[model samples]
Target: MSQENLELLGQSIAPGESRTVDFSMAKLYTTTKVEIPIIIERALEPGPTVLLTAGIHGDEINGVEIVRQLIARKMNKPKAGTVISIPILNIFGFLNAERAFPDGRDLNRSFPGTKTGSLASRVAYHFTKEILPKADYCMDFHTGGASRFNAAQVRIVAGDKQLLELAKVFQAPFTVYSGNIRKSFRSTCEKLGVPILLYEGGKSLESHKQIVKTGVDGVCRVLDSLGMLQDQFVKPPLTESGVLIEKSRWVRAQRSGLLHVKIKCNKLVQKGEFLATITDPYGTMRFKVLAPNDGYIINVNHAPIVHQGDAIFHISTQAGSI
Candidate 1:
């Protein structure tokens, strides 16, 4: 169960060896080393390598929990290839319990970065240069920003038959067609020819049990398909692929007031159905929000107050079966 000369980030890793590599790039203001621990597990038989990551946005605790559960359950110990789990990629952001880097930059937006760039960009630079090249596929966990709660879903760009197939295999609740942002990690992975499946679930700063379970189960299914899943773990039964969301739009609050949601996320609603109510502080004014069309409610705003133009829900305008 050992292969010779498997080098990663200038360190030699023998096959079947489990190692935790502390990636040190910079130091804090107190001169403390900022180390990002990368947990790796390799199998004796050579096959594809999969990289699993979370915490690009520090406040998205559900994503972090999903990756944590995978490691705690020993799911990363692959049977054929290697599994690399970086549970907290943005250590700086995580320490502060903030979404962005200490410098106010979103780490997810810094990709294929430069050595002399901002802190986030520099971290991205080293990761892109040293670690990402080894991954044949990648799964990056994420969640809805702030108080927006998203249904467990996998986001993939349109027209890539291969990635779409993998998304189906993962079997999250939904598979959404989304365009990659410029300079985002998903974009960089595409440029490097590495297929990536981005998962979104729950809301920031919270860990939902159902979300974590969905994510962990999806990863197992993907590994099993790749022949990397271990024999000890029971292979998960294939479920219907996530509902393919071809097009979706945000349903904004029509008036500024204290909002009350009447339905939960992932619920199917008919057109003109009551979704929420907005009321004024004086108790003199009330406004009812209705579904614009028949679609699934994929996201919901958990915040109690909303402005006139704030987005309160994400409804799929078009959906199809795989």
Candidate 2:
């Protein structure tokens, strides 16, 4: 590829070249400049360009670690296509160890934003304008929000054959056909004709070694499937074929109290099975939490204290449930 044909941030990268670009964003209160870090790897041959982004919700660290390890291991040295790695997309939130930007807006929900919009919106605007247009396939990595632990899973929009095939190739133990949320990055990308996958695992602000490994391996597998990586670089099978889930629901707390969860993520539960118990501080009052249907536990809230109607467990029902 000629330098003129490959450009990002007004810079050209020839084939078989790799470069790191820092795109400037808003400044900190202390006048420190914050930039989004991007690593671009252009292969010697022409193929699809795959974009891998993590830390959109800053506290989700598993994807950050996965991207770090991926870059360290030279996984970006694709044999046939380009790999754009944005390890941390929300610098402000990352710095503060929070989920949203410093302005308290969710970056993931600020897609297709305006230039004169909020901080999150401006960041999203730049990403949408500069980075996303280059992607043929995209994967956004994430973890469960605060106090929740999720089993490794890939979420895709339903009825997209190409995305479903790619999700199957990822083999993340669970593939959720989730509906689109307005302004979400995935929805915006879909509207722009880019096939995107969202990988969720572990929990915010903490690294689960196994989950990180799974993410790294799954990424390589997807690249291999896309012909971006060489066969030799493809990962060994880390899991059996993932279950494609069409329906899921969160089991909520019945009453406010201290919660004791009896089940773990990835475990199968029968209908009406014992899942948890809520007890008062004095243990004078107790309420049993039971599975609403036969399904697999995909996520669990780790917080001991719960309020009435709080989501406690995320269950992916069997195919029949749909």
Candidate 3:
């Protein structure tokens, strides 16, 4: 039998249907309404409901691009299940080109919020209560905060074999073991028993082609594993099951100066490998930043200049091929 009609935001959409629901909340100072577009697609056959979301950080344009491509290419139209894509969750921050809500709160850190909380908290409360409960599986996209460009990877809390297997199926370049932060979306998903794979790539405000492709391809692999990918798309080939980073640490700059990086994000480096150089703008003194240990360069700082203690590189302390 076909799946029951999906209900969201007080609207009912039956099987083999497509709908776009506008989630409206607080308006701008000018009283203009801002709506978050939630696109839903369902198949004739019954299967799992997968939720795809991006732009939670607002400045993470690469994540936004990834979801946008999935919709534009018709990838969200599943074969046997339902797909709901929310390309930009924090429309307020996206509109202002800021990282946090207008009230200066990170929407991600305000999950399961109070009914009368701040604007960000209210958005979180409604989403956690209304929308999140309907999802069988969830995928959230993100990027490095500012100048740090992260390698394409799926992050999951360690020790969950189910989530680990799902990450393997997504097949990003790396599978990172990260603990869920309190009040964060990943933690909320865990609390609600919804499996989530959090993807991080590139950096905020910049959309890289390769990073977007990796994200889109990873989504395809995950959907195909669940038997939800459309027939028009081919299943992605399996590569390395993806490297597992058990532990990681940042390589910090020892001196403040103009920075020049020499290695790519996913490259493996030796302990003493020359990774980058921090030099005085006037060419007086220079300091070489070497790898702290032998591991993959999973994140690189793309800033033109750095402070004495700024993190310049994220190197894996312990990693093994899965």
Model 3 lDDT at residue 303? 98
Candidate 1 residue runs with Cα over 4 Å from true position: 1-4
Between candidates 1 and 2, the lDDT winner: 1
CA lDDT, candidate 2, residue 303: 96
TM-score of 2: 0.96
Evaluated against the true structure, the overall lDDT of model 2 is 0.88
lDDT values, one for every candidate: 0.93, 0.88, 0.93
Between candidates 2 and 3, name the one with more favorable TM-score. 3
Tens digit per residue, CA lDDT, model 3, 1-322: 2499998999999999999999998888889998999999999999999999998888889989999999999999999989999999999889987889999999999997878999999999999988999899999999999899999989999999999999888889999999999999999999999999999999999989999999999999999999999888998788766899989999999999999999989999999999999999898988999998999999999999999999999999999986
Residue 319 in candidate 2, Cα distance off native in Å: 2.7
* Quality of model 3 by C-alpha lDDT: 0.93
Residue 247 in candidate 3 has what lDDT?
Answer: 93
Misplaced by over 4 Å in model 3 are none
Q: Put down candidate 2 lDDT per residue, 248-311, tens digits, no spaces.
A: 9999998999999998898989999999999999969999999999999999999989999999
The CA lDDT at 128 in model 3 is 93
lDDT of 1 by residue, 68-135 (tens): 99899999999888999999999998999999999899989999889999999999999999999988
For model 1, how big is the CA root-mean-square deviation? Answer: 1.5
